[model samples]
Target: MKYTRILTVGALMASLAACSAGPAGKAELCESFDQLGTQLLSGNGIGNPLFRAADSLGDVAERYSAQNLGSDAKSLHAIADSDGTDSNELRNATMNIAKICGHPLGLG
Candidate 1:
């Protein structure tokens, strides 16, 4: 009985982790952008750097989406092309986009 209980708990935990690890939903993505916008407007100024980064990321995302390769290896290559030339700016921009677009698409 003790072993059975432990096994059951382990299975439950594994299932929960798998569910949470799924891709971001549309709602989550929207919420991420909304939260970033709110932070920018809240006068923290910290959000300025992130906002600029997000803008760049948005441009990249748009371009990738246009080519229908936003989620493909081609997109990564594009990111590498952009980043390899300007490591600092590329890092900052990608970070901002991740923050703002980290959530699912329609979250907000």
Candidate 2:
């Protein structure tokens, strides 16, 4: 089911990309990415929040992947791309992202 969701998101993003064909489309995509991140951070409850976070993470990843930002997807892709996975930078970045999104991961 998780895999399916990922595929679906990827497909959806691709379709969106096709429809949006200029600077305006890029701005809209970027806004959607930011909004999704915000939604992830604002999740309430305990376990439910984690699940929502996971889902939002996936969606954000898809958006970032669509952006084709390479290793510079900022805080979120730092860990995934393993550019700072072994250092405190990754942890700090992760925490900052969570905090910026209005969710504190408390892993720092």
Q: Flag regions of model 2 displaced more than 4 Å.
A: 1-13, 16-72, 83-88, 106-108
Clashes of 2: 0
Provide the overall lDDT of each model, using Cα atoms, as 2-decimal numbers.
0.44, 0.43
Candidate 2 lDDT score at position 13: 97
Per-residue accuracy of model 1 over 12-88 as CA lDDT, tens digit each: 99999877555544344445445534544443354344344344334344443223324422333454344222334
TM-score of 2: 0.27
Candidate 2: 10-residue stretch with minimal lDDT: 82-91
Tens digit per residue, CA lDDT, model 2, 1-108: 999999999999999977643333334434434553454445444544433333334344344423443222355443444422322443344443443344444321
What lDDT does candidate 2 reach at residue 102? 46
Predicted structure with the largest lDDT when compared to the true one: 1
